[model samples]
Target: MSKEMQEKTIGFDSFPVEIIHDILRYLRKADMSTLYSCIRVNRNLCKLVIPYIWNNPMPNTYSLINLEIFINLFDEKDKNLLKNQYELDIDDTYQPLFNYTSYIKVLDPRGVRRAAFYWLKNYYVQKFPYSDIYVDFKNNPIIDIIEKSLLRIILKNSSKIENLILDFAEKYQDIPSCNIFLLKELQQGGEGGESNQSEQLSHGIREITKLSIMNPSLKRFDNIQEFLDLLPTICTNIKKIKFYDLFFIEPTMELKLCNVIKSQRNLTSINLTYNIFGLISVIRHQRNSLKKLVLRYIHHNDICLFNTFDQLINLEFLEINECFPINIILEPLIRANLKLVTLKIIDIEGIEGKYDLVESIIKSSGSTLKHLSLNIYVDLIEDKLPLSKLCPNLIHLDLKVSIRVIDEDDDIDVESKKQPTIFNYIDSLKHLKNLHLEFAFYVIGYFEEFDQYINFINFPSLRFISLKDQHYSSNFFKRWFEHFSTMFNKITFYIDSESDEYYFDPLDDFVQEMNDNGLSLVYTFDGYSNFVATDRILC
Candidate 1:
């Protein structure tokens, strides 16, 4: 190596071990590839990074190379077992330095199942002719054996597993004895009688408290009722249950879920999407320990479900997303008198009750509510609600006005309408901090009208304002943010749709102007997943 390179290397090595460990920890978590590259830097770097990389060694995604590395971790006996029993071809030439599974304190069997299926499909595609009738992976016995074998090996190796997430895939649905078999192996006493073995299995399963059944595809499974009932019996002390994309809500499944809820009194939080039956089931059980609840895609017919919300005494955080007939839900919700700290009712759509429902929810939780987000269906500027009655302790507010254009030939007189302007009541919210506002209609040539609406109000506690969810010219966004720069701590403009050519020049000019003026303003685009704040930004 060159003299300068040697000197640089020595400089990095001279740093204290604690500092090196801290730096390596970040790279290990944030950038695995970069962390792996550092293994060649020095002996000290290699020693510090190896543990973090191996802590969760199993690759969740499709990577043939990584799968080979995983296979090589097994010793000679386990390697032979895989070859003889499962018919998996082991690479004799490759050898691993250490047992990687020993470092794992967590196991996600669903991820391993997904990766194995992905690898098998790709492997078969390369060796066989492509056909329209796809392989039925659900009925594949070899895949089932491979999945269970991998899971059992990992569970056996990890002596102190603290977390386990189960995806109720096809195997768990079809194979009734899958849980019993897996748990029997996990227990130390395998040769006990049937009654003793059942006790041991329950004891074995209760060691983990955090569980997430993330079946995003929402595939309906047979014998789901039995599976749902088995969860509480196994993991009696489970604290949280997260259900995602559970679209197929059945009566028996709901009954089983309610039974599970009644059995597990330790459950504190539940997060579900598009599962009205599950939501109703939670309400029916009346669990006082439940503190947080999230519901998505709630329909109008589900209004009756909120009648039981009053029973939840410890409920603090509630979020309802994509709720239809948004206005009717508020009466029952308000009657429940839920002293919520964070309340977000997003994507609200209905014709008449939009104004009254929002007014009531705000008034009911005015004393305790801290974070509030609302997406009203009507034009917020044309049919404004009384924002002055908002929660006194509100810290964050997201409001979107859906209409920005007025038809010239319409018969209704603008002067006769009694609805308040958008800016009329914001000055009353004393504790409001973060603000997100969306103007989502065609308003390109109406900058004067937009500016006129912005002139009437100022929020004393406002920190930032995000203008998003619809299309607008980049220049118009820049001009608006510049006008209100002093009124906010920072201003963000999210342009959802724009001509690629028209946006480039104006976006560049806006960034340059913000730089020159020492202004805190950002311009971004809805890169993925609609207009969510978590989406990537272009600038």
Candidate 2:
């Protein structure tokens, strides 16, 4: 045997198929570079890795080539049916060898639109040689037709698709002239077009799926309600729905949306953005089965509308962001008594009884809260956010401290800085596992004092620490890093200031030392970082 063939025989070729599958699972979780390397090792490894790599393929400029191959796979009868039924024009010259669409399990229509546009540009450039074609493809109805056809075919062939995201509405909102159905002329020959397209789209999808419609910016066509109404037709069993940036037109339309949400009998997770009064109806509809809820960017006027949350009896995870008129939200939150395991509150406006509400939530759900995060301004020492006393079982905690600058001549409010700093209560949370502290300070002395408080805190159960500062040099953080022992499994330091090579160079060295010692370090300076942690680390 040749030397190369003899050596190749000693590699993973000898391993069992089950062992190879396990190795691919680990590689699937590894970085993109590692996975690419694994598939190149041998034919067996490549075959095993192809499924994992193609499951959630990253659609980019090059993806158009693969998409072209998939498009060519449509049989002669399928192409003729599309042309005759939907009035779509198909190029039949190209024939495909592989059934590429069957490998796609996670579909993103936005990515398909991007890939379609790229392919169209290249096709036009090559076709119209010697002509300056500044084509406005975004407004082209043909592009929309092509994208929908591709999506329809993939969904029809790939029965394994369990996760789907259709977020093109926002990206295509600027092109008002282009509509999904406008590309196809009426099958009967005039204007009304075929009414069975939604049915055809529905027939393509054969499995229940997790769906995310981020910013369905379809108000221009007066079709937001129509789109919402069509979701159930496409997927009979939607396990989770993440709807963001939804605009409420009127009470009647909102009622329609509420009715549509109510129809999803299997829905268990509802994440809705923009707290309109209409959302209360949705919360009321899903109250029985909903276990997780998220609402974002609520105005002061909408605060009282969420008294509907009190109805979510089975809710285990609740998150509210940018909630104004914090007073109104507190009472309902406390009254809910959800015994939630996770709670996150951010950018709360209003002061009166706000701290009391924070304390009340902890006291109410203290035993069950495994994760808690709060972002608010306060007198760290005097505010009644009793963390250590109230929460004894918190596994993850995130606190963002806001500091105000005061002139030396002005009378300092000693009430704000009465006794101990925010760190004084840290020792009380004996079960705390992960902690993130964020604060901004202008004065150097205040920064030093804050660091001193952190250095003295006793965090025995802490496995991860994230420190973010807006104004401070790396030297300040280096000194703070020296205080913690090797018990910490991961440490993150982020400074939001202009980049300085001299200051950041040492921090990089410190991060390298931490990594060498079996601890991970994420150091960012000037809004840039060397390490970017994924969802796995935080979870």
- Once all C-alphas are superposed, what RMSD does model 1 give against the true structure? 6.8
lDDT of 1 by residue, 1-539 (tens): 99999887776668898988898779877898998898888777777777777666555665542455565544455667667875666575666665555566556665666656766666566656575435455666555655665665565555455566665654434433445324654455456577866555433345666666655224555444446667667656767666666566566666665565567657777777674565555654645787777777767465666667656657688777776655445656666667778877776352334656566656767678888777653334354445656576777887765542358986544443413355664546777667776655533132234534554555566655555534445555555655665454344444444337566566656656776444433334553111112211222
Cα lDDT tens digits, model 2, 1-539, are 99999987786678899988887778777775688788778777777777777676636445444455655655455566656864544565666543566677777766777777777667666777777866455676556666666765666566377776755355465322222322222223323345654433333333645776655454544454555556554456766777776664445555655665777776788777775556555677778888887777766565547677677778788787776666676677677777788988876342324767767777887788889888655453355555677777889988776655447785657444632556665556778777876653432335445455665677666666766655556666666655654344344555444567687677668767776544344434555322212122222
C-alpha positional error of residue 46 in candidate 1 after TM-score superposition, expressed in Å: 7.0
RMSD of each: 6.8, 6.8
Top lDDT: which candidate number? 2
Looking at candidate 1, the ten consecutive residues that score lowest on lDDT are 528-537
lDDT of each: 0.59, 0.62
TM-scores, all candidates, are 0.71, 0.74
